[model samples]
Structure formats: C-alpha cells, structure tokens
Target: MKQVNALTVAAAVAGALSLAAVTAATPAMAKSVKCYGIAKAGQNDCGNKAGTHSCSGQSKVDYDGGDWKGVASAAACAEMGGQTKPFKGMNPKKKSS
Candidate 1:
C-alpha cells in the first residue's frame, strides 16, 4: 500500500510536469493566417480580394492583417484565407459561398 501510494503521487507529479511543459512549449495561437476563400460571401469575406475569386478556405497561414471577428474562429478564418480588415454590420450572403 505504501509503495502504491508513493508511485501514484510520483505519477501525478510527473503528469502535471508534463502538462506544464507542453503548455510552455506550445506556441501562442497565431493572430491570423493567409487562408483561402471558399465562397464569395458567407460567414467570411475572402472574395473582397481580386484574383483569389473562389477558394477552398484552405490557404496559407498569416500572422498579420485586419481585425478578428469573434463570430469566426481562427480555424474557420484560416480555412477562408487568413484574416481580413474587420467587417462592420452583419455579414449578408452577397455572392454565396
């Protein structure tokens, strides 16, 4: 019983340390990324830009540009083509995604 208790405590401490290390090593969530647009206008507006036209929401990662909309998650925005200049008012279905 004593050995088991000691082992359990050691394991718990090790696990906690591991978790802390992971948290420390993990990079801060990037503010933005260079993503692609899957639609002209849906939850996001990647079509505002020229050339891109329609994208799969799968573009490159960008750390800068525009403000973030809480409505769109980083992952979701990433799928659309990074971030864009913060939008105002509700987003309407202009071109369809």
Candidate 2:
C-alpha cells in the first residue's frame, strides 16, 4: 500500500510538471498584437480586412495592407514597418510582385 501511494504521488507530480512546461512553452498563449502590411504573399495569419478571404495563408500579394499577422506587440510590429490597422495598397517599403 505504501509503494502504491508513492507511485501515485510521483505520477501526479510528473503530470503537473509536464503541464507547467507545456504552458510555459506555448507561444500562442503569449501576448500578441495584430500587425498589418508585413506578411509575405500567402503568409497572413488570418482573414483579410477587405473580406477577400476568410482564412489564413490566403493573401495574393506580398506586404498587402489589407492583410495582417499576429506579432509580438504593437511596437514590434511598427518596428517591422507594419500598421496596427488595415489600409489600402501594399507597404511602401516593399514592391508588389
């Protein structure tokens, strides 16, 4: 009975530790900001503001202002030449192909 109790406790501890590690490593749970006009062609994270597409990775133009991606933060997105809101045309820094 003592051995069984010890094993059960050990398993419970291991399971808890595993859950903690997974939670810590999950980037999807981290803070993020919506960044526009930075995603490459077919690389947007989700739907476009123009209502052209309803899914991820569907943009037909590189650096299109109507599309967006999930970035680490607003400052980070601005640093990467991205806008917080959707706009018309592509990013001036990039030429459309």
Candidate 3:
C-alpha cells in the first residue's frame, strides 16, 4: 500500500510537470512582410488604397501568442516611393490577400 501510494503521487507530479512544460514551451506567433515605399498588399497605402502600393501611413498591429495571449499597438509606417522600409508595416486592410 505504501509503495502504491508513493507511485501514485510521483505519477501525479510528473503529469503536472509535463503539462507545465508543454504550456511553457509553446511558441509565439510572429509574422513578417516585405514593405516597399508605395506598393504592397494589406499594408496601408499613403493614398488609402492597399494591395498595389507600399504602405505610407499609420496602423495597429496585433500579435497573438498561439494560446490567445497577445499584444497590440499603433505604429507609424512610412517611406519614400520605390523604397522598402526596414520592417514591413502592419496591414490595415479589412481583408489580407
């Protein structure tokens, strides 16, 4: 009986540790894009139209960490025509294609 009790406790602890490890090991979702000065898809186009020109405005970015835990913020995306920004700006279009 004593051995069985000890084994059961050990198993429970192991199971809990496995669950914690899995949760902690989960990866966050990250996205990357190419942002040209005036032509791109989904990103804000200075003229208000997207999908054909690079973005040149401001937008909000939302990053989800797979488990629904996420973060969001507003950012400014601007550049000269025919130039690509260091990092692609956020897309503000209702739909991204």
TM agreement with the true structure for every prediction: 0.29, 0.67, 0.29
Q: Against the hidden true structure, what lDDT does model 1 obtain?
A: 0.42
CA lDDT, every model vs. true structure: 0.42, 0.90, 0.35
Strongest candidate by lDDT: 2
| Worst 10 contiguous positions by lDDT, candidate 1 | 62-71
What's the TM for model 2?
0.67
- The TM-score measured for candidate 1 stands at 0.29
- lDDT string for model 2 (1-97, tens) is 9999999999999999999998885676366788999999999988999999989899999999999988888998999999999999999966666
Write candidate 3's Cα lDDT for 5-78 as tens digits: 99999999999999988776444213322233333332342322233323334322321011011112112223
Q: Which residue pairs in candidate 3 collide?
A: 38-53, 38-54, 39-53, 39-54, 40-53
Candidate 2 residue spans exceeding 4 A from truth: 1-30
- List residue ranges in candidate 3 displaced over 4 A: 27-97
Give lDDT tens digits, candidate 1, residues 1-97: 9999999999999999999997874453333343332332333323334333344232232321322223245577655554434333322322222
Better of 2 and 3 by TM-score: 2
